[model samples]
Target: MERVHSDRSEQLYQLYKPLLFSLAYRMLGSVSDAEDIVQEAFLSWSERRPETVLNEKAYLCKMVTNRCVDRLRSPGKQREVYVGPWLPEPLITEALDSDSPSGAYLQKESLSTAYLLLLQQLSWVERAVFILREVLQYEYDEIAEIVDKSSSNCRQIFHRAKRSVSGLSGMADTVPLKSESLKALIEQFIHAVASGNTGQLMNLLKADVSMHSDGGGKVTAAVRPILGADRVIAFLMGIASKAPADMSFRIQMVNGNPGIVSYIGEQPSSVITFRMENDRIAEIYIVVNPDKLKHLPQR
Candidate 1:
């Protein structure tokens, strides 16, 4: 009987781990912290009396959600004092595309850096409520139960959060180009940068394109967002000119979009992901913080 119970617990963990991790990652915006919360939730679940739990999935989700809220609400979290413009730790496509029963809830747009940063603008509770309703398609009652709020209150919070992020959400609604097309554009971008073809690069970027680099004060990076196509091209060229002779670029799926990863002799030096508007790169997110890149699959 003890062995059987252990097997059952293992099955339950396997069934819900992905869903719980998705919820926690969206709420906390840190891959490592999200993973820690999910692990802690399962540990707590294992200690609970089986008979007392009515719905396993809901109970597990509630556990993960509340823990994420607590982590976000904790005083002096790193984001408050993060060096330069902060970007969420990149979640590579393989991890994002892992097989899971609740995979439908993990919408591609919701996982983008732009969307995650917009989520940061909301209050912790509001972020939880919005993600539950908007991304996960939870009913109001379900969200209320997870959040420990009244159904009506959850509805109100969702609406308020929706209004706050409506602009970016509207942009997200645009139909994305086919994957092949995006890859071709990325290839063109690489060639343009590598060959010092400013005119070609200018045509690939939007007039108002902006680039953000997050180094976490551990490496050299721009302290402020670089704006406009001309400035962005100049910055890219400047980096290209100074980059080591051994540096190489590879295309990888980053946050559900094709992106570039730069390597300096097998060590990942940077990960770059782009946000597109009308087939042009509108926003570029480059994460160079070594601490953040530790989780990336080694070359």
Candidate 2:
């Protein structure tokens, strides 16, 4: 009987791991931390008497959500003193196939650096409630159960979070460029950067384009955001001018969008992701933090 129960628990964990990881990742904005929370949740679930739980999914989700909330509320000074702009660790999403639905694209957008940064603006509980209600479409009562709040209170929190991140609410309504077109643009942008074609670079960027670089104080990076197309172009050109002879850039799927990863030899030096608006690059996120790049494949 004990062995049978163990087999059942493992099956449940496999079934819910993706959903739990998604919940924890959205809540905390850190892949490593989210993964840790999911593992811990699984361990806790295994120790409990199976018959005592009414719903396995909800029970697992509640454990993951509450752990994420607790982690966010904890006093963490790492982000407080983080060097330069802070960016979420780059998430390499699965390539979209021809049969992929539009909803899959939108889901990938939510994982973008820009969207994740917007989520960081909310308070711990607000972030939890908002992701549950908005992204996951959980009912207020279900969310309340997950967060240990009343249904009405969860509703209010969700509304407040929605208001705070209203800029991103239109994400679902806006149709993104097809994957092929996006990849073409990324390739063109990369070529322009490599060849020092300032004119081409300027044409690709929006008037108010902004670039953020995160090196975590361990490497050279911009300490503040570079705003406007001209400034952004200049910064890019400067970096290009100083790039080592062996450094190379490869385009890859980053956070569900086409992005460039710079390699110095076999090690990844930086991951660059763009946010486009009206067919122009609106925001650029460059993550060079070694700690964040550990998950990426070498070579």
Candidate 3:
């Protein structure tokens, strides 16, 4: 009986791992933290005697939720320990890359780092409630169970969180510029930067453009977000002009859009990805701080 129960518990965990990770990632906006929480949740389950368990999925989910809530309540340790500019850890095309795993379709908007940062604005419980209801389509009852709250309470939290996130949710669906289009746009962007063509760059930006970077304190990057087309263009050119000639870069598809691969003497220095919203680019994410890029796979 014990062995059979153990097998069942393991099977249940396997079934829920991806879903739990997705929820955690959405809540924390950090891949590493999400992974850690998922692992810890499973560990919590493993330590449990399978025979004593009931509703394995619910139990595991509560563990994951509890772990995330703990992190949310006390994030100083995580934030204080972080080095440099902390970007949401990037996942390769293999991880969140496929919109459907069996179908192997690339998720156009999944790569947008913009959505993750926006998620940061909500409280811990609010983030969990919103993701569970909005992103995953979990009903209020299910969410209430996971968070140890009443369904009515979950609804209220969801409402407030939805309002907070609605404006930014449009950013979640940003389509990455395709090869030819992105190549042209990147050329234009880079050329504009090289020539200080703020006009040309501004023309390429959408109404509410925002740019962010993760130099992680190791490299020099904007400590704050750059907003608006004109301001973003100015910032881009400044970075371009300062880049060492030998600090050459190559263009690659990152987060499903045309991105720059910064190199120093053939070693990868950083990856800069753009989040596009039609004719104008919306967000620019530069991940130059090396430590954070360690988990990023070769694209």
Query: Best candidate per TM-score, number?
Result: 1
**Model 3 C-alpha lDDT per residue in residues 169-190, reported as the tens digit of each score:** 6644555456689778888876
Better of 2 and 3 by TM-score: 2
> Cα lDDT of model 1 overall?
0.86
- Return the TM-score for candidate 3, rounded to 2 decimals: 0.78
Looking at model 2, residue 163 earns an lDDT score of 81
- Model 2 CA deviation exceeding 4 Å by range: 95-107, 167-175
- RMSD in order of candidates: 1.9, 2.8, 4.0
lDDT of 2 by residue, 54-130 (tens): 87887888999889877876777347877789998887664445243423423456787888899998887898888
lDDT value, candidate 2, whole model? 0.84
Q: Give the CA lDDT, 0 to 100, for residue 32 in model 2.
A: 86
> How should the candidates be ordered by lDDT, best one leading?
1, 2, 3
Model 3 poorest 10 in a row by lDDT: 101-110
Candidate 1 matches the true fold with a TM-score of: 0.93
Model 1, which residues run further than 4 Å from truth? 1-4, 95-107, 168-173
Compared with the true structure, all predictions reach lDDT values of 0.86, 0.84, 0.72
Q: Which segments of candidate 3 are over 4 A away from where they belong?
A: 75-86, 94-111, 167-200, 227-231, 242-261, 265-267
Q: Estimate each model's TM-score.
A: 0.93, 0.91, 0.78
